[model samples]
Target: MLSKRLVSCLDVRDGKLAKSVRFVDTKDIGDPIEKARTYYEEGLDELVFYDITASSEGRDILIDVVERVASQIFIPFSVGGGIRSVEDATRLRLAGAEKVNVNTAAVQNPDLITACADAIGSQSTVLSMDVRRAEPCDAVPSGFEIVIHGGRTPMQLDAIEWAKRGEALGAGELVVNSIDADGTKEGYDVELTRRIAEAVGIPVIASGGAGRPEHLYEVLTEGRADAALVASMLHYGEYTVGELKQYLDARGVKMRMRF
Candidate 1:
């Protein structure tokens, strides 16, 4: 079996690291470059930087911040938020990001997915979905709806269906973020993660609501996720990436113990 990955996410707003609950009440945490270097040194497998307000503010991603963070971290780094076109993806790549994460823009124009995959390899294109739980209906049979614009707008699209469609559009990976579970620190929405993972052939990264190492293990195994995206736990100094990796490794979840 392939080793499971532990990815630390830095939600950047105005070049400062921030954290939010259910996509609201966001507070500045620290400098993005400092936090990025800290996680990378703590044995994090991957790093994801999201400009939280970029989409809602109608602006481009902070390329200067991306470049600085990229220079500090040697691990695979992915950037997202406000990425609108192939040109934007190219800019991020030139700024030193290994992959470009497309969220709101991809939902608005899915062809952007294929365009990025064509320009860069599919492996360098990541599809990020902000999803929330809703009542089961004809449109959202799975009861999970896709939300966009930093969770301000809700789309009629179903989360599971969107995941499959994203894969067909050449998104090499999927980041299934549960808005309902984000920053809750209770645990991941394993059911939500599993549903999307089962519906798509591409690797799914289970994001949101990770409180402990056990939560990581559950999402990676029971949720059938290839990786787990952690924010609150790591951002607040609740746990270090090295500690989580050791805990998961001891419990039989294969991890890259590079440290």
Candidate 2:
């Protein structure tokens, strides 16, 4: 079996690393470049940087900041927010991002996914979905609705359906973020993650609600996720990437351990 990956997320707002609870009450924490370097040195398998306000602000992503952060990290770097076209994705790749993630713009124009995949291989195209629990209905039969603009707008799109569509559109991977569990640090929404994992053939990264090492184990195994994206637990100095990987590796979850 392929080793499960542990990814660290750096949510930036106005060029500062920030954190939020339930997609609200955001507060700047520290410098993103410093954090990126720390995590990379501590054995993080991948890093994801998101410009939380870029989409809503109607501007391009902070490329300067992305370049600065990229210069500090050696792991696979995936960037998102305000990427509207193939040109934007190419620019991010040129800025040192191995993958370009699209959320709001992809939902607005799914063809953008195909376009980016064509420009920079599908393996470099990541489809990020910010989802929330909703009443099961014909519109969202999976009971999960995709939200955009940093979870401020509901798209009424079914999470499972969108995952399949994203794969069909040539997205090489999927990041399923549960807004309901985001920043909670309690545990991942295993059911929601498993449902989407089973629905899509591409890799599924479970984002949000990672508190302890056991949570990562559950999400990686029971949740059937290819990777687990962490924020609060690692951002606050609660756990280091190496420590988390050690705990997971000892529990039979294969990890890329750097000794």
Candidate 3:
């Protein structure tokens, strides 16, 4: 089996690393470049940097920060937020991001996904979905809705349908982030993750609500996620990436162990 990836997320707002609960009450955490280097040194498989407020603030991603963080980490680095065009994606690539993630822009114009994939390879195009559990309805039969603009707006689109559509539109990977579970430290929404993972053929990265290593294990196995995106746990010094990897490796989850 392919080794499951452990990705540390740096949610930055105005260049300072931040953390939020269910997409609200965000507070600055630490220096993003310092944290990125720390995680990379701890053997993190990947790192994702999101300019969390860029889209909502009607601005472009902080390319200077992306470049700075990219210079510190050698792992696969993915950047998102406020990327609106193929040129934006290409700019991030030139700034040193291995993958460019599109969330709000992709939801607004899905063709942007195909366009980015065409400009950069599909393998480097990531579709990030900020989702929240909702009442089951005809429009959202899957009971999950897509929220955009840093979770400030609900798009009324079905999460499962969007995942499948994103794959068809040339998204090589999916980051399914559950707004309901974000920063709770409870655990991932395995059911929601499993639904999207099974609905699409592309790799799924389960994001939000990871409190411990066991949570990662459950999401990787029961959730059928190809990777787990962690924020609070790593951002607050609750656990290091190597410790999480060691825990998962001991539980028989395939991991790229450094020691």
Worst 10-residue lDDT window for candidate 3 reads 52-61
Clashing pairs in 3: none
Q: What is the lDDT of candidate 3?
A: 0.90
For each candidate, give its TM-score against the true structure: 0.95, 0.95, 0.95
Candidate 2 TM-score, true structure as reference: 0.95
Tell me how far the alpha carbon of residue 59 in candidate 1 is from the true structure, in angstroms, after superposition.
6.1
Candidate 3's TM-score reads 0.95
Lowest summed lDDT window (length 10), candidate 2: 53-62
* Each candidate: RMSD: 1.8, 1.8, 1.9
Stretches off by above 4 angstroms in model 2 are 55-61
Among residues 3 or more apart in sequence or in different chains, the pairs in candidate 2 whose N, CA or C atoms overlap within 3 Å are none
Q: Write one digit per residue (lDDT tens) for candidate 3, span 175-258.
A: 999998888889999999999999999999999999988999999999999999999888888888888999999999999996
Distance from true location, Cα of 57 in model 2, Å: 10
